[model samples]
Target: MTHHPTQSPQFFLTAPSPCPYIEGQFERKVFTHLVGDKAPEMNDLLTQGGFRRSQNIAYRPACETCRACVSVRIIADEFKPSKNMKRILRRNADLIGAMHDAEPTTEQYSLFRTYLDARHRKGGMSDMTVLDYAMMVEDTHVDTKIIEYRRRGPDSFITGKGQGELIAVALTDKMADGLSMVYSYYNPELEDRSLGTFLILDHIARARAAGHPHVYLGYWVEGSRKMAYKVRFGPQEHLGPKGWDRFDTEAV
Candidate 1:
């Protein structure tokens, strides 16, 4: 039987694995490769359609009989920082960020390994090698960029590059509407830095500066502490079957 190339996009299924975010649950995913000349274009379209990337694969939750992982994005222009978010940003004032091409390096892999070991040792990526980590950063086929955070140096304003140590790294997708944080990690040792929160805060400002309407923050599972932070970025929208639904925790 003949088939259309685009319509018959190659798809693959992942082996069942334990869910990291939720207890007593298993997870599986159906993925397709992002490669070749059209990879960037394909990645953009697939991401807009709700797929997340892992190295060369574009995937999303494909668990049988479950639809709990709903995608979400922040309407950056409308979003206002909560009291806690303001404090978090103030606490991280010393950090300076440098944006660069999505290219991987030894220092980045070192930090990535350290983060996984300290924060996600038992999770799926704990066993990843340096090469594996490189692929994660460098395999992107989209308009991907890396934001490196470090302590502000003497020449930071001019260089826009921070020094000291790579405390945090964000793998972000530069979308037409706004930035999509694909993945992020920080030096697990500095618990007080609140790098995770700072990263989101920075992205909101970034989206506003770029004249982008939204900054996609991905899913926010209600009962998960790990995901609860996503909700703090007020005046956000949660994607639903009908459309993007505006939600205000204070109003609820």
Candidate 2:
């Protein structure tokens, strides 16, 4: 007879810290390590249960008083880009994103540093060094990928790869039912291109092409100006006590 071992993940609670999203609120997270052969399956289950992945850790808010952080996922198949979103697409028509293995490169680290320095100077990840960035990209146990965005070259159609400077990058995970966007960063100088919005739209298109039903966008914290853009992706589902439910931004 053959014997197989079952993988069980042990969970831990984080010490409370000042919330980055809401004022006068504290944040705590319940997290578990994601490793070994069954990591992909475990990631899918935890993501569906409102957990977000960071490197090898899967965490969800466990605050005592605040229930403002809500998990959100885009309905990829039924998504229709609004006029502004269409304009963003048109504005960035010259770019193409090529999916690659989750390997860290110095080029990517340089871009990441510039982005953090310019945009998130005071954020938690502001102090990340090259080693830290490399670990973020490489320390994964699931089906993870990095999509590098650049200007479409003349031979882009033949090679399916872009050329010149790297414009943006997305670190994502492939799940059983959907694609979960772990993190993404772009060149801050190209603000006019609305690269952030373009990244989400491109992911929606990618999810649809891959026959995935949803594109997980992490948490949407209520009353956080920084998270308000997430709601613009309409017809998305928000995980609540009763499970995932359709959220109408207009009605709120």
Candidate 3:
């Protein structure tokens, strides 16, 4: 009898830590590594199961006492920008996003540092060094891409690329069902352009143009003001014990 090795992944639980979203609450997680040749397939399966990727690891909140973190995915094809969203898009009209292989660069790291210092100074990733940033972008085994947003140049229409200053950056994962926005940062000084909202809108458009049905936005923690903006995108779905279902913000 011939024996073939099993390729099942092993999951481990993280020790409880202070929740970053909701104060006075603790958070734990179940995680597994995303390595080897089967990483892409495994990533897709895990993502659908409510796990989010960070570099080579896929994790989801697993607190025994709380279930506030819910997985969210925008229904890309069905999404329609609201009046304010339309205004944000118009405000960022001069910026263009060009996607490329997930390779880190000094320019990206600089922008990343500025964003962290200005907005997320107390967040978990606030102390990441340049090497850490590179690993975050290049350590993934699954299909990933880095999108660099820049001001549109005069020749942008012909080149299909942007130029002059890296205004924003997004690290995304291309899953079978949708594009997952793993991480994103932008020029905090460009508050007038509303670059953060524009990135999400741009991803929705990209997903729709590619014929994808969803755009994964990771977790939306209930009662977390920081995550309130996620629910503003209509026609979204939330993963629950019963599976993915329509999320009606009005009913919340």
TM-score quality measure for candidate 2: 0.97
Give me the displacement of residue 160 in model 1, in angstroms: 1.4
Query: What does candidate 2 score in Cα RMSD to the true structure?
Result: 3.0
Error of 1 at 186 (Å): 1.0
Worst 10 residues of 1 by lDDT: 1-10
> Which model scores highest in lDDT?
2
Better of 1 and 2 by TM-score: 2
Clashing pairs in 3: none
lDDT (C-alpha) at residue 31 in model 3: 93
Model 2: runs farther than 4 Å from truth? Answer: 1-6
Q: What value does the lDDT take at residue 163 in candidate 3?
A: 96
TM-score of each: 0.89, 0.97, 0.96
Model 2, 73-157: lDDT tens per residue? 9999999999999999999999999998999999999999999999999999999999999999998989999999999999999
The better-scoring model by TM-score among 1 and 3 is: 3
Residue-pair clashes per prediction, in order, are 0, 0, 0
